[model samples]
Target: MQFTSGYGAEPGAWRLPGANLRSYTDMDQFVRYAQAAERGKIQLLFFADTPVLDVDLERQVPHFAIDPLLVMTSIARETERIGLVSTASTTFNEPYSLARQFKALDVISHGRAGWNAVTTSDPAAAANFGRAVPPRAEKYERAHEVLQIVQALWGSWEKDAWVLDVDGKRFADMDRIQPVDLQGRHVASRGPLPIPPSEQGQPVIFQAGGGGYGLELAGRYADGVYANPYTIEDGQAQRQALRDAAERAGRDPDEVKMFAGFMPAIAGSRRAALDRRRFLDESVDLRQRVRYLGAMIGLPLGYRQIDEPLTADQLADAVPSPHDPRSARALEVAREGWTLRDVLAHGVIDYHPVVAGTATDVADHMQQWFEAGACDGFSLAIDGYHDGVDAFVDQVVPLLQERGLFHLDYEGPTLRDHLHAREQYGLDPRVTETAAR
Candidate 1:
């Protein structure tokens, strides 16, 4: 799931005819999306979060308005099997608090919770905490230390710590519970988490971010990786890199699943899908499109003609803005000689690859990537919210299931069971089900 709101991955999604603008704050909207994904036996519904109001709300609808964990909690009650994952920044939050919250969520969901650890780069989020944004190196370093503390906290309480001895009149075992006392360069914690492990043990750890320090953190701790790769080849290389990193950290490489982010625009036919993409592309007003294009290339383009070709010098001068790290992808498209209009039409502002096609077409693309070692699966986003999820679940999922590439039903009750679904796809020879640590 891209979001639990009306506005999806498409920037102009809210402007579509009959779009529900009120769904952003409505709890029922999230329940609908979660139930729909559950019907398809989708492994998980992921929600991305930013603590600050980062977008220009006057122009674009803010997607990260509500707390994702709170929303996921509501969804967790409404749905039975689908996994619920939410982003929580390691940079700004305390390790013990986040660890406790996620553990409680896991217990509440009966082991269907996942936490996406991120080193948030948004400077506005830093301002909310009355601190300047830390440098890239420092942020990742802190993230490493924080994750260590959180993991230790999660494991503090032994499986049998909460004992109920009716005959003996003793209800607990103090010796079984241990305190975590770890001191790192950036953070330290001393505690035994009050919450014990849930049915599947601790919540699955997912790491989001891509280069150097990010890979190291994921390799050491994450059971899954959330990634954005613009091309299949890039995805394949990233998978190999993650696997290598895991192996270097003395963990099983295959245990670290990479879910590359992809947004698909699906319809009954290929031409219709393309037309839907076009409709979404033209939904935004020209001025807003110009602003978006300018933001993508880090330039002021309100004065420039929309159809005019950007010069080589202009493309060369383009650099990533402080807030938007995806600007480079747009510049890459512009350097290929696309006009400003063409760039926006191609949706270059988003770093995730988009597929506009029929159900079969989408299924074929996913199958090819999986077979080619590009990714274990995708972190799917939609062209629209409710309709987009229904279209894929109704249309594309059956095709994948028919081809034996996906599970027809969930193999187990926990999120880890769904992820490590044994004997389902047979894509990896080493695939196995192991309890979460």
Candidate 2:
């Protein structure tokens, strides 16, 4: 199945000195951008977020971003066809609330809302939630239980739940109004949810985790997965595992779409693209970049200044576990002792796979992955906002269109239908008191 291109919107993208800050903060700008994405024939607009603000980030730019769900609702009114996805942390919120918000957004947007379900992993997030330290593996365990409860809640109200019999004085049919009185390890909500079944039946369940437990959690429920796979080979392997696991869990294996996060640098020429990447490196402040990188792979680099080669022991000792059950790609890089200097110089730390010849070259790379079954689709990450998207649309998208890999038009009115998803779940709500990691 061919997947659609989705953009991850972060507010501080167009970081030009004296640039109009109003564009990032204003809801109107989001509306304009959503329209622009549709004009480019982009299929989805997803916002990935965490609850805790980076105190350090405020030093660089003013933090004035609106809520993703609210922003998505505004964008939904302004545009058509582009899927609106938002990150909702499962750890701090109840399943009922999360389900309600997503279902309501789906209704308001005519069935275009998407839920990127995440368990907030940051320690600061734990602090914000009144935990001295976040529950480690248990958070994911509870998340598993929570997913079950939410799925059941979505199922609570069947597609034919409402029997509007006005002549008989019946407001609705109580028979179809299934009550998902759920209880789980960490989440519990008794319902009959307030809303009827959403337009698509349920909001798309988008998951982001990279472990055996995480995999099991996804196989049982999620319709899509967001993975930061470094290479096409890694993506393909993970996709296979996801399919195999889902099938084992009695779900349609093909129902789960795999998406790899990709940041491509494209220009008129290969040299120009290379130069652009180099410029991105040179322009970024090294220390701050190092700290950012440190946080990503779970390192505390800012606290220490030892210039030594990293070892397997050092990497393994610091991290509670390997990056995941199957792969230790991040740990492998850390073990090689890639310092901040080396990382910036080589782009080897979070090595982004690039496609940099002409437009043909980039298309060739994309086609290679598609043929290899690396992913059902991709989430395109821009180095900057519109400029990066502009290059892809101007150069690579046409090439893809010519190659028969790109969609000339949208398939359906709703995002769920646009993605060509089959309804895997019916209203059989799995109720639980709380979640298990």
Candidate number achieving the greatest TM-score relative to the actual structure: 1
Residue 414 Cα positional deviation in candidate 2, in Å, after optimal superposition: 1.8
lDDT of 1 by residue, 102-140 (tens): 989999999899889999888889899888889999999
Please give the RMSD to the true structure for each candidate, in Å.
Answer: 6.2, 6.9
Model 2: how far residue 165 lies from native, Å: 5.3
* Model 1, residue 25: C-alpha shift (Å): 1.3
Best-fitting candidate, scored by lDDT: 1
lDDT tens readout by residue for model 2, 1-437: 01111222222344533333555467776675577667767778878777766646443332324577887888888887888887788788888888788888887888887888878778886788886444658878777766667767777776775777888888777787777776766778787776776567777888887888778767766778887776667888899999987776666788889887766666777666655555555445667766655655666766244234454555665552345331244444456565545433334443345444466777887788888898888877655444665667777787888889989888888777877776634432221211221
Q: Which residue pairs collide, candidate 1?
A: none
Question: Can you give the TM-score per candidate against the true fold?
Answer: 0.84, 0.78
Total clashes in model 2, counting residue pairs 3 or more apart in sequence or in different chains: 19
